[model samples]
Target: MLAPPSASPRSVPGLRVPGPRTEPAPGRGARAAYWARLLPLLAALACATRLPSFRWPLWSPDEGYLAVQARMLADGGELYETVVDRKPPLVPWLYAGAFTLFGDDSLLPLKLLALAAQLLTAVLLVSLARRRWGDGAGRTAGVLYLLISVGLNPEDAQAATFEVFMLPCTAAAMWCADRRRWGAAGAAVACAFLAKQTGGAVLLPVGWLLWRGGAARRDTGRLACGLGLPVLAAALLTTPTGFLFWTVTGSGAYASFTGSELHVLVRGLINAALLAAACAGILPPVVRVLRIARTGAAELWLWLASSVAAVLLGFHFFGHYYLQLMPPLALLGAAALQILPRERTVRALVASGCACAVFLAWGLLAPRPELAHATRLAQAVRADTGPRDRVLFWGMHPETYWLADRPPASRYLTAGLLTNYSGGRDGPQVGEKYAVEGAWPVFRREMRRDPPAVVVDDSRGKPFAPDRVPSLRRILSVGYAPVARVEGAVVYVRVGR
Candidate 1:
C-alpha cells in the first residue's frame, strides 16, 4: 500500500487506514470482490441523486441550445456554419450520437450518457484513492463525489452540462499523472479539452508533476504525441475557419467584461457562498490542506489550484463551473478522513448524505420559470405548424425549438446575436457592443433563404421589443401576422399560409 509522503500510519484503534507504506498488491480475487460490491452501490447512489433530472423537460437553455444544435447535426446540418455555438465539437457530437441512438425526442439516452460519465469519474477517483491511501478512503472518495455532485444548483446539478461530461476525462488525467503515466495523462487531458475548453487547465498540474518527477525525455516526447492525436482527428473532422471562429474568436467576445464592477463582484461572492454551502461536508479536508497537509500532498494542492483557475476561466462563475473542483476535493477529503477516528468519519459521511438529500429534494420540487414558459410556447407552435416547418425564437429560450420538435431557421438560435445579451453577465448591453459583427446580416440572409413558417417573440419586451427591431418588423409586416399569444410570447404565422 501507498500513503501520503513522509507520514506514517497512526495506530488508531478503530480507524481503517492503510496498513503499511509498501505492501504487495492485493490479489486479483480481492480486487474483483471489492469492485463487485462497490460498483453497484455507486451506481445506485448516482441514480438516486440524479433522479430529479429525468423529471425535468429541460435543465437550462445552455443544454437546450446544445440539444437543438445536435438535432440539426443529426439532420445533416454542419456545425459552426449551418448551426453555430461557441462550444467545442465533442459535446455536440456526443449529443448528436445520443439523438441518433435513441430518437431525437428521447432525453433518457442523454441522461444515461451523463450518468455514465459521472459514475466513471467516481470509479477513477476510487482507484486513485485506493492506491494512495486505503480501501476505506477510496470508497469514501467515490461516495463523496456522488453526493456533492448533486449538491448544487438545480440547473447545473440536473443537466448534463459540459462540466458533467468533461469530469471523467479530467479525473482520468489526474489518475494517470499519479501513476506516472505521462503520455496517457496527456491523452486524457486532450479528451477533456475536447469536451470543454476549461479542460485544458489539466495541463498545469500534469506539467508540474512531470517536471517535479524529473521525467525522461522520451516520456515528454510520448506525452506530446498523445496530446496531438486527438487534436489532429478533430481538425480533420471540422473546417479550420469554422472551428477557430466559434471556439476562439467568438468565445473571446463572450468572455469580455461587460458588466459593472459591483454587479460582477456580488455575483462572484454569491457563487462562492453557494459553493461553500453545497460542499460544506468536504470543508475539513480543505482546512487540513491549508493548515498542515500542503507539503505532504502538494500534487493534490496543485490540482485544486488549477481547477480553481479553470472554474473561473471565463470569469462567469456559473454553478456548473464549480464541478471541476469536486474530484480533487473529494480525494483530498478522503485522504484526510482515512486517519480520523470512526466517529468523525461517520459524522462527515452523514453530513454529506444529508446535503445531497436536501439538494435533491429542492431540485425536484423547484419551479423552473423558463421550462413552464417554453412548454407553453412549444405547445402553441406545435398546434400552429407542421412537424417539418422551421420556427425561429427571437429570445433567450432555445429550449422552445427543441421542445416543439422544429428546426431553427438560423444558425443563431437565441437573440444573443441581435440583443448582445450574454448569460451569466449583467444585462442585454446597449448599442450591440458585444454582438458579433455580420451576425444580424447572416440571420437576415438565413431567414430569407429558409423563411420560417412561424416566428415566436419570447423576449417579453424587457430588453427590447420585437417590433422595435426595424429589420424584423419589416419582415413580419411584409409576410407574417400574429396568430396567438401564449403566456407572454406572441406567436406569428406567415400570411396566406
Candidate 2:
C-alpha cells in the first residue's frame, strides 16, 4: 500500500515537482540598502572635512609654489626652461589645465578638483574591499579612508598638492589589480607616478600581484606598454633632457641627506611622533588586522610596506607625505571591522570619526602667521607695481607672486636653490659653506636679461640678511630703494617709476 501511494506521483510521466520556495533574509535586504546609501554618505563626509579649504586662498607652501609654476606653464612657459621645480610634469600641467578652464587665482576650482579626486579614491577603496570581504567591510573601508586622510594637519590634507592628486591613481591601480586587469593597473600606477614620484612605489605590490596571479606573456607586455606610455608622452611634450633632469637627476640632490647625525636623530624622533599621531585614528582596526585577520592580509601588508618606504624615502616626513599610507591602512582596517561584533564596530568607527573632526578643528584654529605676512606683502607689492611690472621674491614665499598677480622676473620661483635652504634640514646655514655651483651665475644672467620692477626681500635674516648676498645688495643699491616695510618683508621698488 505504501509503495502504491509513492508511485502515484513517481510513476506519473511528463510531470515536474517544485522544490520549497526560498526567500532572502530581511536583514540581508536591509544591509544591502544600508550599504547602497552609505557610499554617498562617505563622500559627503569627505567634502565636509575639506570644506575649510574653500575659504583658504593658499593652503601650503607646496601648493603656492606649484600655483606659480602652473601659471607659468599655462602662459606657454616650458618646464625646467621657462619655469623650474623639482616635481614631475603632470601635476603642474594639471594645474595649467585647471587654470585654463577656471582662470588664474581661482582656488575654489582647485579645491573642488581635489575633493573630486578624494571621493573617487574612497569609492575605489570600497570596491576593492567589497570584492575581497563583503559590503559591510567595503563601507567600513570607505568611511575609514575619508576620515584617516583628513586626520592629519589641514595644511597637508586640505591642499591640492601632488600627494592629494596621486591618491586616486594609487587606489585605482590596486583595484584594477584586484580585478586582474594588469594593463589598466599598470597605466594607473604610471599616472600616479606622474602625479608624484612616490607613486611609483605602487609598482612593487602591483608587480607582485601580477606574478602571483600567473599572468600570461601578453598580459606582461600590455603592462609594460601601459607603464611606458605616460613617460613617453611626457618626454615628447618636453625635452627628454629637461624632463629627466628636473624630475629625476635634479631631484637627487634635493633628496640627499644634508644634515648632521644629531639633526637626523632629532628629526627622526619628531617624525615618528607625527606618524603615530597621524595613524591614531585607525589604531583599533590596525591592531585587529595585525592580530586576528592576518592570514589573507599579505597583499595589504605589502601595499603598506611599499607605502612606508615611499613616505620615508626623502626623510622629509612632511605631513602630506603620510597620506600615502591611508589607502592600504583603510583596507586592512576594514577587514578588521568585518570580524568585530556589531556594537564594537559602531563604537570603533565613531571614535575614528571623532578623531578626524578634532584634527580638522585643530587645523582650522592653527595660526598661519606666514600666510598673513604674505598677504600684507602682496598688498604692498600690488600698490607699488604697474600691471606689466615683473616682481622678484628673494625668499621662499612664492605665494606672493601669485597673490600679487605679477610675472616672476626670474625662472627661480623661490630662492631655495640660491640659499640652499632644504626643508626639514638644519637650516639655510647648514649648506652655506658649499655653493650650489652655477646657481649664482644663472641668477645673474636671468636678472640682467629681465630686470624686475620690484624685488621683495622676504628672508627675515634667519641664515643671512638680504644685504648679506653681495649680488642682491648690488642690484638693490643700483636702481631699487625700500618703498614699504609690511610685516617682516621689505619691498624694494625701482626708483623714479
Candidate 3:
C-alpha cells in the first residue's frame, strides 16, 4: 500500500516513537496526548493517500458490470435477485444499496464513500499491527501498505473497498486470539468470511492460532459459533438465486481453484513471488517499526505468500484479487519496521526496493497513452447518446461505458457483436468451448436482433489480437463499419443489415 502522503509536518519531534527501544519520552500523559492526536493524523494521511486526483484514474471493463448490477439493484431488485452473480452478495449488494440510497451513483458522495473506506482500511491495518508490534513497526508497515496499495487504479480500489471494512474485523479478532480471546476471534473470523471469500481464509489463520496457542477444541467450537455461524447463516439466507448463479453460471466464469489450466498455477505463483520479493526488500524498515513481532515477521511472509498462492491460483487472477494478501504483508512489514539496523547497507536496500516498487507499479498501472483516443471517442458517444440509447462497444475499451454515463448492461460486453446470447445451455465448459470454436455467425445473428447496436473497437494492443483477436476480426468484418477513428481506437456502428 502507498503511504498516504503526510500533510502534517514531517519528523515531528516528540511524536516519533522508535519502537520499544526508545526510552526518551518525558511523561506518559504527554505521550498519550501525542498518540491521540497522531491517530487522526494517520487517518487523515491515509485518506489523502488514496484520494489523489480522484477524477477517475482508469476504468476496467469489469467496473461496468459492477455499475450495471448496482444500477439494477437500485432500480429495486430484491435480495438475491438483485445481484447478478453468485460469488457473494456482499460487494454488489453494497453497491446496490449505495446507489439506491443516493439514487444516482455518478456524483461525489459515492466517490467519498469509497475514499473513506480505503482510508479506514489503512488505519485499521496500522492499529492492529501496532497492537501486536509497536509504534515504530506499525508506522513502517503502514507506509509500506500505503506504497503497495496505491498500485490499484481508483475504480478498482473503489470496487473492492467493501472488503477493506471487513478485513479489520477479522484482523482484530485474530489479534484477540493472540491474547486467547478464542470465542471473540472465532466470531470475527466468521464475519470476515461472510464479507468475502478471503474472510473464509481467516479460519485457517485462526485455527492455526488455536493450535499454536494450544487452546482446547471446546474453546475453538465456541469461537466458531460466534464467528462462523453467521457467515453460514448469511450464505443460507442469500441462497437460491445467488447460489444457483454460482453453481450454474458463475462457476463457468470463476472456479479459479478447480481450474486445470496451466497458466492458472503459473500466474498465481508469479504474483506470489513478486509479492515475496517486494516484502523482502522492505523488511528492514518494517523491522524497525514493530519490535514485538521481531521473530514472527519472517513466518508471516510464508503464511501471507501461501495465502496469495491459494487465492491467485484459485477462481481468478484479476489484479484486485490479491487484496486479501495485503493485510498480512502490511502486518509483517510493520513488525519488521521495529528492528531495522541503521547500517548504510540496510537503508540502501530499502530505498532501492522503494524505487523498484514504484517503477514496477507504474509500468503495470500507468494509463496507456494509447487509451486516450478511445476515451475521446467515448466522450463523443456520451454527448450524442440519446436517453434511450443502449451504447454497445466491441473493443478492448469497456470502461468507456462508465465515462459515457450509460447504464452498463450491454454497453461493455460487445460479445453479442461477436456471438450468440441465445446459443448454448451455459454449462461449465460452454464459454471456453464456444470461444475456442471462434465462430462469427453467432455474433452476426445477435447484432441482427431488435434493439439495434452501436459497436466500438480498436486494435492498438494487437491491432491484430491480444486476448482474442482472431475473433476480433470476424466481428469487425461482418456487423460493424468504421464510424470514427481516434488515435488508434476505431469505433464502429453495428448496422444489422
Candidate 4:
C-alpha cells in the first residue's frame, strides 16, 4: 500500500517537484568581473605615466630640501642636531630609508617609492569601498582615485610632498576602521600623523566610528595605547624644546605668512572643482548619501568633513592639500558609477580613461622653466666643488644643495626664515622678531665657525637687502669673491682663506 501511494503523482518521473532554487551569484556579471580585473591595471598605468618625470632636473625647493636632509640622515647626521627643518621627522626618515636602500644622490628611487605609496593607496581605497558598498563601487573607486590623484592641478601635484607620503597610511586607517579593527586603525592613524602634523585630523572621524560600531571599552583603550605609544616614542627621541618649538609654536607663526583666508578659500574652491571634474562620477553618490543618511553614508560625510578641515587648517590652500579630499571623493564617485546601467557605466569608464590619458600627456609635455638653468647650476657647482665641500645658498633656492651633492653650511635650508625675519613688502613689524634677533645670531656664529666653500646668492641679479641679515652680508664681503653667475644667481668662492 505504501509503494502504491509512492507511485502517485508526486513520484511521477516527468512531473517531479523542484527543490529550493539557488539565486545567481551577485555581481557575477561578465562586465563586473572585467571591471574588477581592469582596475589595478589602470591604477598601475596611471603611476607609470609619471615615471619619466623622475629624470627632470628641476624640483620644488621643498622637495629638494627634503632630499638633502634625507641624504644627511643617511650619511650619519643626527636629526635636530645636524639636520633641522620645521617638518616632522617621519618624511625625512622615510627619505633616509630610501637612500639607505638606493643611491643617495639620485631622485629616481625616492620617486619610485612615492609611486608605490600612491598605488598602495589606490588598492586600499578599492578594498574599503568594496567592504562598505559593493564590488562595482570598489572597482570604480580605485580607478577614479588614481585618475584624480595624478590629474590634480599642476601647482603642487608633481612634487612628492608630505601629503603624498601620508595618503597610504590615511587610507589604511580608514579601511581598518571600516572593518572594526580598532587597534590596527589606530596604528595607521598614528603613522599618518607621523607623516604630517595635520594628519592628526583623521582621529576625529575614526574615533567616532569606533564608538558608533559598539567597540568595547577595552578595544578603545587598545586604540589609545596604540596611538599614544608612537607619539611618546617620538617625543623621547626628539628634543622637547626643538620639536615643540618648531611643530607647535613656530608652525603657528609660519601659518600667519601663508596668505589671506579669503584668497586661500577661493583658490581652494577652484582646485576642488578641478578635482571633481577629473572624476565627476562622485557627484551623484555624494547627493545620494546626503539624501539617505545611512551609517555608511554618514561615515563618508564625516571623512569629507574632516578632510575639508584638514585642508583649511593653515588657510594655505596649496593644490597638494586638496589631495586630502581625493580618497573620500573617489569613493563617492565609485558608488555613483555603480548606480549607472551597465552599458552607461562602461561608457563612463572609457571616457574617464580618455581624460586621464589626456592629462598625462599634457603633464609630460608641459615646459618646466627651471630645468635648463637648474641643470647648468648643478653642473657648475659640481665641477667647482669637491666631495667634502659645503655650499650655502644665501637666498631661497634649496635645489642647489641636492643637485650638487654638497652639504649645507647652516641648518637654515630656505631663506623663508630670513624672509620672515626681515620685514618685506607684506607689512611693517609683521616679521618674527625672535627669529631676527635670536636665530640670526646663531646663523652668523655657524657661518663664522664653518664657512661654506661656495655661496650662491639668489637676489635676482641685485645685492641682497642689508636689513635682512647684515651679518651675512658682512661675512660674504669679508672672505668671498664673485666667481660665476648662473640663472640670476651670483656664485661666490672664498678668495684668500
Measured by TM-score, the strongest candidate is 1
**Model 4 score (lDDT):** 0.69
lDDT digits (tens) for residues 1-497 of candidate 2: 01222233223332222122255433877767866798679778988878767757988878888888888887779997778777788888888888888988777788898999999999999988876766677888888888877766678788998999999999999989888888898899999998988998998888888888897898888888888898889877888887777777765445666554466556556655654565565676566434533335677878889999998887666778888988998887776666555665687678777777777887777788888888888888888788778999887779888888888998878766665565544453434333344567777887888789998888886553556667778888987888777777788888776
Better of 2 and 3 by lDDT: 2
lDDT score for candidate 1 against the true structure: 0.80
Give model 2 RMSD, 1 decimal.
10.2
Top lDDT: which candidate number? 1
- Kindly list the per-residue Cα lDDT of model 3 for residues 369-436, writing each as its tens digit: 53465568778767656655666655545556656666433321434223211111222332323331
Please, what is the whole-model Cα lDDT of each candidate in the order they appear?
A: 0.80, 0.77, 0.53, 0.69
> Compared with the true structure, what per-residue lDDT tens digits does model 4 show for residues 46-68?
56655544646434666787888
Candidate 4 lDDT for residue 476: 78
Off by over 4 Å in 2: 1-36, 260-275, 288-293, 427-438, 495-497
| Clashes by residue pair, model 2 | none
